[model samples]
Target: MSKLFLLVFIALSQRVQSFGIGSTLYCYQCVSTQPGCSPFNWFWHWSQACPEDGDTCVKVIERKGASEVVTRDCLSALKGVRTDIPADHYEGCKPAAVDVKLGNYVFSSIKELDVKKDYYDETTFCFCSFDNRCNGSSSLKVNKSVMFSLTALFMVIHFLILR
Candidate 1:
């Protein structure tokens, strides 16, 4: 009936509305390597570190031709590495170590400390309704109930009119 159609339309119009807000946090951890070393040269290359924590150190080596072997120190060379907490609640990157130097050539007679860097990133999302009246939890509940009632009333009216 016309009344039924009207009720259905009203009910459909009163739907649960939602919106979202998001934020992200980033952190970097640096692992120091010999000068001119590239983290990408290695299999896994990512950069990540704990913002609050200092930096992390990682050792790396480089291969030249087929026989030449090089050793070097890499600092926070990885990219998109994650060192954040509460893994499930948020998303972040994880860093890995990479050997950048190739061929055994000792710059100094003494062995230098090898180090790499790590980083962390975070993202968040908040969802809410568009209606100003549905700003808070209680408001949202009230709005939902009101919407349902209006839809039901409209449907009843439509049904009676059609009949």
Candidate 2:
């Protein structure tokens, strides 16, 4: 019994030591309308390794007026910041989905991005995914929203033109 117990202890210790190697997550990043991060271009580029404390890759989009900011990085990537909401602190890559709406933007601090400009009713979307460079694809999900809105607008215009 004692020998078996010792073996189990050793196995547990080995697993603990190996944990360090698997902690990091790789993700892609790009600002608004960049040709480099487009779906076709992303695969050819290198990814950023998430910090040990960052578990999942995150894709965040914020639109204010005609200017939009898009960023892809590790979840909770921002550290040591004083904001209304504390930064999310995660330890390893995990799968998660979140959607929230707040004053033309979603999933981010209202104060972080200046809202003083002509606030066009915009929807901010934040997506998190696990696996290497997952954020790149997740960020593309935003395009779907844009496409849907455009399609609806086109139909409306067509109706008006026909009338």
Candidate 3:
């Protein structure tokens, strides 16, 4: 009886270890409308483990005349919105447009050219599957070199004007 119990325990432990093979990905979860969380403070929101089949983390930003909305969630959470990203959807950000008739989703380098005015002034979706908390920030960041040059130019201009 002792031998049988020992073997059974070993088998069960192995099975349990197998269950832990696939690691779950975590993502930031938040909404711009959440009270006391406006303006998107990194500390205000929390990270949540994605669903079993959810491998993508998405951050959606929508801008109108003067209002903007930001949303961060597991891709699976936005299924109701109906943007069907194919399995081959590339990683990174792009202007998002939805088909008015079919309601299908598409992307473009320029938002205003592709998306209808009713959609918004701009809508961008950043998709990532490579890292945890990947959807936390905008994908397209200004080049440091460009910023440095711009700052130097501004200083030169200011000094020249003073003289």
Tens-digit lDDT string for candidate 3 (30-143): 888985334555566767888856578887788888998888888887765545333444687777754555524645557665343455677788788766666775442334
RMSD (CA, angstroms), candidate 3 = 19.2
Best by TM-score: 3
Position 78, candidate 1: lDDT: 26
Clashing pairs in 2: 55-92, 55-93
Candidate 1 lDDT by residue in tens digits, 1-163:
5656666675556434322112211221222242222332322322232232222223222232443222221123322432221222222222222334422363543333322211112222111222222211232244566666877786676567556
lDDT (CA) per prediction: 0.31, 0.50, 0.64
Tens-place lDDT digits, model 2, residues 22-128: 66666775654676653336655567777655466655555557666665666555334212222343333222222233335434457546443223244333445
Error of 1 at 1 (Å): 7.8
**For model 3, where is the 10-residue window of minimal lDDT?**
13-22
Root-mean-square deviation of every model: 18.3, 20.6, 19.2
- Deviation of model 1 at 60, angstroms: 35
